[model samples]
Target: MTFVTKLSFASGDRDVLAETVQELKDTLERKGAECKGPHASSPETVSVPQYKRLRAGDEFSPWRYDVYKRSMEIHGADDIARDVVARDFPDSIHVEVEVDRKKPLGHRRD
Candidate 1:
């Protein structure tokens, strides 16, 4: 069974928020889960190189308190959200997640 997971964050900064998101992604992957989706940032723009590093998992750094909101449509993921939630995020940041118990099938309901 699969489900749609919507992760949201309210932080003091964007840079650090991005880092936290990346770490969460890694953590999810490590726990045998897969995630995918586009991101919406308040800055209105994310550089190309920055995107590349994040995609390649090579741009993690210490950042200020920043809130991150990550919405993922995932598969075969259980307890992953709980574990990720347990991670220690920056004090200046807050993370939230909404998990929808519906698997995303390729077939559309026309």
Candidate 2:
């Protein structure tokens, strides 16, 4: 079975989160990590205020939460995972990785 990497985060700034996600995706491609998904997907993103309230938090003192996700298939190995972990990340949020249920079309099978 193939492994994968997922970088995700929650933030109080939706625009920043959006930018980070895009930047990550671009970095993955420019650095040639064999990424896929989201190219044909449109994930539902929420604003800082809306996100807080959606999670049942008070807007006045928002608990600081937002939704952002980026996924890259690791092919039959974990090269993608190692590469992503080696990349630099912004100070505004955190990143976490996970496995993908389906193989990303962009990943090389060999």
Candidate 3:
């Protein structure tokens, strides 16, 4: 059996997001870990409505911002994936991790 760890990162700042992902890719490569990619996604705009008063009689313009996203997968490298996930990231960046267990070809559940 093998494990594939997927990491997803998102942030309002594109520069910081790119930098963080790049650094992680470099680290994984240096450690001889099999990495899939640091795939990037199109920026997404998010809007939030604001109310001037508690009663909401008057409302301000909707606050809008762009969010950037990047993702990568560490294949069959549990130690490297664990280290990367354990490290602290910037407050502005959001990280998500998912692990998938892969069985060898023709393998079946007993």
Candidate 4:
């Protein structure tokens, strides 16, 4: 069996997000891990409505921001993937990891 680790990173700051993702890719490469990519996605705009008071009588302009996302996959490098997941990241950056187990071709359940 082989394990593939998918890592997704997101942040409101595009520059910081890019820097972080590039650093992670470089580290994985240096460790000889089979990394798929640091694929980037278009920024998403998010809006939040603010109120002047607890009541709904008054309201303020909606606050808006853009979120950037990037993703990559590490193939058959459990140790490196684990290390990457365990490492601490900046508060502004969000990281998500998903592990998938793949069975060899022609394998079947008993």
lDDT of each: 0.62, 0.58, 0.94, 0.94
Q: Give the TM-score of candidate 2.
A: 0.49
The best candidate in terms of lDDT: 3
Model 2 weakest 10-residue run by lDDT: 38-47
lDDT of the structure predicted as candidate 2: 0.58
Better of 1 and 3 by lDDT: 3
Colliding residue pairs in candidate 1: 7-70, 8-69, 9-68, 9-69, 10-67, 11-66, 11-67, 13-65, 13-66
Indicate the residue-level lDDT of 103 in model 2.
Answer: 63
Q: For candidate 1, what is the lDDT?
A: 0.62
Which stretches in model 4 have alpha-carbon errors above 4 Å? none
Residues 8-94 of candidate 2 have per-residue lDDT tens digits of 554445577678767767766776666664332334555344444557555554334435444434443366567667777677656
lDDT of 3 by residue, 1-110 (tens): 99999999999999999999999999999999999889999999999989998886689999999999999999998988999999999999999999999999999889
Shift of residue 3 alpha carbon in model 1, Å: 2.8
What count of clashes does model 1 give?
9
Using lDDT as the yardstick, the better of models 2 and 4 is: 4
What's the TM-score of each model vs. the native? 0.57, 0.49, 0.96, 0.95
Tell me how candidate 4 scores on lDDT: 0.94
C-alpha lDDT of residue 89 in model 1: 81
RMSD of each predicted structure: 13.4, 7.9, 0.9, 0.9
Candidate 4 minimal-lDDT segment of 10 residues: 54-63
- Runs in model 2 lying further than 4 Å from the true structure: 38-77, 100-110
Count clashing residue pairs in model 2. Answer: 1
Per-residue alpha-carbon lDDT of model 4 for 1-110, expressed as tens digits? 99999999999989988988999999999999999989999999999989999988688999999999999999998998999999998899999999999899999988
Model 1 earns a TM-score of: 0.57
